[model samples]
Target: MPQNIYLEDYTLVQPHSNFVIAGGRVFIKKWTSLSFNCTIVTGNHKPTVGLNQRIIERLHINDIEKDVVIGEDCWVGANVTILSGTMLGRGSVVGACSLLNKSSPPYAVLVGTPAKIVGVKFSLEQILKHESNLYPEHERMSRDELEVLFEKYYKGLKSMGTDYLSPEEKMKSMQYANMQYKI
Candidate 1:
């Protein structure tokens, strides 16, 4: 029942779900939502061992200082587990039932058990610029202002692109493609 969960620039719905988040800054950029049943645990994983002694001394679990930053315009699927020291970049999508053990780069889509980068959301320059704008210290702008900026840079890309299917749709398409696998 820990409250005061630090959520910045991130949207979280289905609040009744149980989860623990500690000692890490959670930056939820614009349009990013953390769905129900998601657990973000931020604590030290380093186990301390005493030298020259067979017994283990006090385990020094450092104050897991790294912030869990979820970039802007991203969707975090349900039942997602984000471990300590994880950084998810902007415009990224994390599929459900995924375990994030490592920091993810900007504009990268991650999925599966070990959470591999399945897709790239944007170029390095774009990501860097977006990060600079999204930094907390910078002057905060309205959502409309951000949208206008995005449109200016990404309108052409959006128009030229086809509609991106949801994870469920993609799964169904895959199943359909493999006719050998019966429903």
Candidate 2:
């Protein structure tokens, strides 16, 4: 309902969804789903040294805002808490009762507190198929990158930001949605 909140066609938020959209934007792309009792926070509380809690609260001066993004076709499970500045990459599967605090790679299957990467939602071939329908040919991940991502996942390594989307795409998505995500 706010100007800073952008939901593209086919975005879904189920019952009991709570969003704290403060100084920044919250962008959800097409086909993303948020399950029940999900909480998305787009801002933080400022710690002021001298200000009283009631005064700060009454003045609304204790807010620090940041963007939040849920990428296309992501599945966020029930009772999840997505914190400020987190980006759920395209087709990510977030496990129920998880706490997500950081950005994740595309197609990742995330679970547990702070949402560690446990698996990938699809194989490389399947990912290719999935992205083909959701993204343009130029935007899809190359076979080499897919292989690299799989290797990193297997080795418990981190994914390079460019493995899923480009910087230009990230900027565009941010500009379009006034929200989050990056390459």
Per-candidate Cα RMSD to the true structure, in Å, reads 12.1, 9.6
The C-alpha lDDT values of all candidates are 0.59, 0.81
Question: What tens digits encode model 2's per-residue C-alpha lDDT throughout 105-170?
Answer: 878889999799987787777777656655767877888988887887735533322336688886
Compose the digit string of candidate 1's lDDT tens values, residues 1-183. 245354543355455444444455555555577777877766554444543222222332444545666665677788888876787865677889898878764455778988987655554444445455445434434455545544544433422123467999878867654321221
| Best prediction by TM-score | 2
Query: Which ranges of candidate 1 are over 4 A from the true structure?
Result: 1-4, 16-19, 49-63, 121-183
> What number of backbone clashes does candidate 2 have, counting pairs of residues 3 or more apart or in separate chains?
1
Q: How high is the lDDT of residue 42 in model 2?
A: 87
Candidate 1 global TM-score: 0.54
